[model samples]
Target: MTASHNWPPIDPADGWALILTELQRDLERIDPDLVMGQVKQKFGTLSVSAEASDPALADAVHGRIAAAEALSARICERCGQPGRIRQRPDGWYQALCNRHALEAASEMEGES
Candidate 1:
């Protein structure tokens, strides 16, 4: 039997530890042979690319990944608090709580 995998070693600031854990658990049950290829944050939400040999299994895995990504959009990447999407001066978006948003804005402006 193949060993179960853990969450991809991505940044933890996204408050996604729980989400990743839950996703891994469900994935193990739904598609044991499936493997997560890449996990990253894109456009203010979680993005997970998975690999699977079975087409039907792939669909199920993708569905689960979508669900996790959706959940991440509402969670603060810094503090795991409820959050909203905000855009940076660079035009990139991030899911952050009010306090983190303010801090990030200041940091972007070169403030300490």
Candidate 2:
């Protein structure tokens, strides 16, 4: 079984810990696996469900995604460069400058 302690690093300032904890409790009360199955089955199907207007649920989902995006952005602590991480096929992550990123993409295309 995977351990929570081994999970990837998360931003402490995002308030995700509290939100995630509550979500876990809610899932525990019901079957998370079942909920996931339902979601998968209904994928791409949008309906005006009973709880569609739930303000709290909307707020929670919005807050979490915003926090994640914020954490993904990095302002170079050394050079004051603002950038984000992009995944590489080699399994290594790169923090690229705007110019560097475009150049790298061009090089990869040329290689192909």
The model with the greatest TM-score is 1
lDDT of 1: 0.81
lDDT per residue as tens, model 2, 10-89: 34443233333443344333322212211110111111111212454554444443443343345221122555555444
lDDT minimum window of 10 residues, candidate 1: 1-10
Question: What lDDT tens digits, residue by residue, belong to model 1 across residues 1-112?
Answer: 2215544654556487788778878888887777667778899998888776478888888898899999999998888899988998878899999999998998989943
Instruction: Report model 2's TM-score to 2 decimal places.
Output: 0.27
Q: Which 10 successive residues of model 2 have the least lDDT summed?
A: 38-47
- Candidates in order, TM-scores: namely 0.85, 0.27
Judging by lDDT against the true structure, name the best candidate.
Answer: 1
lDDT of each: 0.81, 0.36
Which sections of candidate 1 miss by over 4 Å? 1-3, 10-14
Candidate 1: residue pairs that collide: 13-77
